[model samples]
Target: MLTEELLTLAAAAGAAVATAAGTDAWEGLRTRLGGWLGRGDARGGEGALAELDAGAAELLADGTPTRAELERYGAAWRDRVITTLERLDGPEREEAAAELHRLVEREPAAREVRGGDQHVQGGIRVHAEQGSLAAALINGGVSFSPPPPPVRPEG
Candidate 1:
């Protein structure tokens, strides 16, 4: 039987795989996940890659998938991971769990921002909505005044 921690790790791996699909992190996650599932068998690794590709394709087919759809895929992958861990022997299972933990640790969190020139020296939050754009380059602090009310046509 798998420990609760391992089971939680499996679930996190599943969610990470699902979220990483179609993103910059997908390739690395896909390759590592294929290796994990393959367990040193070349053909098995190839097959796993094929399966991962198919899942990613399906998830991205709509271009903009709803949150529910993402969750569905996440759950499916989670079940797959749990099943894989369940099939392993004690030592193998432990090693696989450790590997999976590493994979999860390396995965970028959702909405993570990265850029070469961008530097954040302190906490910053920018929110844009309703066809507006917001940006900040804060070294110390900043403030904003509300926009004037929308114009009304003359009577």
Candidate 2:
């Protein structure tokens, strides 16, 4: 099994390759990540993307990633492509890389806010937090707690 760092790197690489080599290349990642994802399976039939869907809930639910982090991930992949081209010979290099760059420019979803975030990671946290807060007052979820003392923690 690949380490967490390797898996994240592979995911980022696959995303880049999906951008450069197109989505077809991402299938390899699906297969490679599939087995690892399956290790935790109780059902033994769920797909990698499904596991990712579950994982995204945990990571992104905290908050949306800062725009800068997303930008850095994209930039690093583009740089990898650039570095690859720099090592190649001549016209063929430019032509091939140009094609990949064209594909890159034609990204399937130019600005999708992917993964979980408060806005994107809907369902549980947003609903639960709001519901719990409301219930705490009305349903007395915190009924056992004493009234605030005059010398308060905040003060």
Candidate 3:
């Protein structure tokens, strides 16, 4: 039976792996995750890499993955991680858990926006000969104003 801490780590790792799939950070996360799980074993690391690739590919191919599919992937990775954790000795388990914590803490890729309120109807053309082309500079430090007309005293 897994302890509370180990169970928490397993859950987090599962979510992180699933969230990372198909993201820009996918490659880096996959490499580090594989290496971590590999535990300095070349063949193990290679196998992990292969698994990550296949999972990522499957997730991406779905276009819009269902929640069930996501859960399935997450559960699988969690089980794999739990198995790995169980194999290690006490100190090794601590080290591996620490590494997994770091991996989870790393930032994930930015999500892309699907839709926006922005609309465009016609082309916009602006020609600037010299200093500034903007008609108005709002909410900025720089301010632009026309020069004051030449002061004239009474003749």
Candidate 4:
């Protein structure tokens, strides 16, 4: 089970590649994602992905990551991400699509961001909002309604 942060990072990477297009960073990142797509199995990069996952998780746990490495790592995650989202259907799919759009808009590859250089032109993107705990609860398939209050006195 992929973490929400990972999924979000993936989306952001997609956005970066999308806006930048032909830039080296975009191409490199796209290449990595393409590798995943080409392989059709993120499970293949188990070791490398695990190392990255652990590193990212540690940074997140420390809550003190504000650097370029994070961005690159994030960009590297879009491959498995967009792939997974592709498997869904209906409302969930729509939600993922909307999230991807927003991500692309916010992190448009054309605009000069802190990390990737301004060079590329266009690349594939699937901006997606990282799911939150609330979203998870909603999607948990558990029905919940306010419990009936104590019987009111007959008026």
Best by TM-score: 1
Superposed Cα deviation of residue 17, candidate 1 (Å): 0.9
**Residue-wise lDDT of candidate 4 within 1-155, one digit each (tens)?**
44464355455654465434333454444445444433445665455345444544654565545556555545555564656566767776666555544444444541343233434344323454666333221222344467579997998
Candidate structures ordered by lDDT, highest first: 1, 3, 4, 2
What lDDT tens digits, residue by residue, belong to model 2 across residues 1-155? 32343233333443543342223544544343333334346453265455443433433455654555445544544344344444556675545444443443333332122222213232222235644643222332222445567874684
Q: Is candidate 1 or candidate 2 better by lDDT?
A: 1
TM-score (C-alpha) between model 4 and the true structure: 0.28
| Residue range 1-155, candidate 1, lDDT tens digits | 77777767777777787788898999999999899988889998999899999988999998977889888987887788888899998899989988887877787541122122334455456999999999866555455667679999999
lDDT of 3 by residue, 1-155 (tens): 66876776776777778878887777888898999989999999999999989987887795967888877987898899999999987888889988887776673311110112223344334567778675532343444467689999989
Instruction: Identify the runs in model 4 with alpha carbons over 4 angstroms from their true place.
Output: 1-75, 108-155
Clashing pairs in 1: none
| Candidate 1 wrongly placed segments (more than 4 Å) | 110-155
Per-model TM values vs. the true structure: 0.69, 0.31, 0.66, 0.28
Taken over the whole model, the C-alpha lDDT of each candidate is 0.79, 0.40, 0.75, 0.49
Candidate 1 achieves a global lDDT of 0.79
Worst lDDT run of 10 residues, candidate 3, spans: 109-118
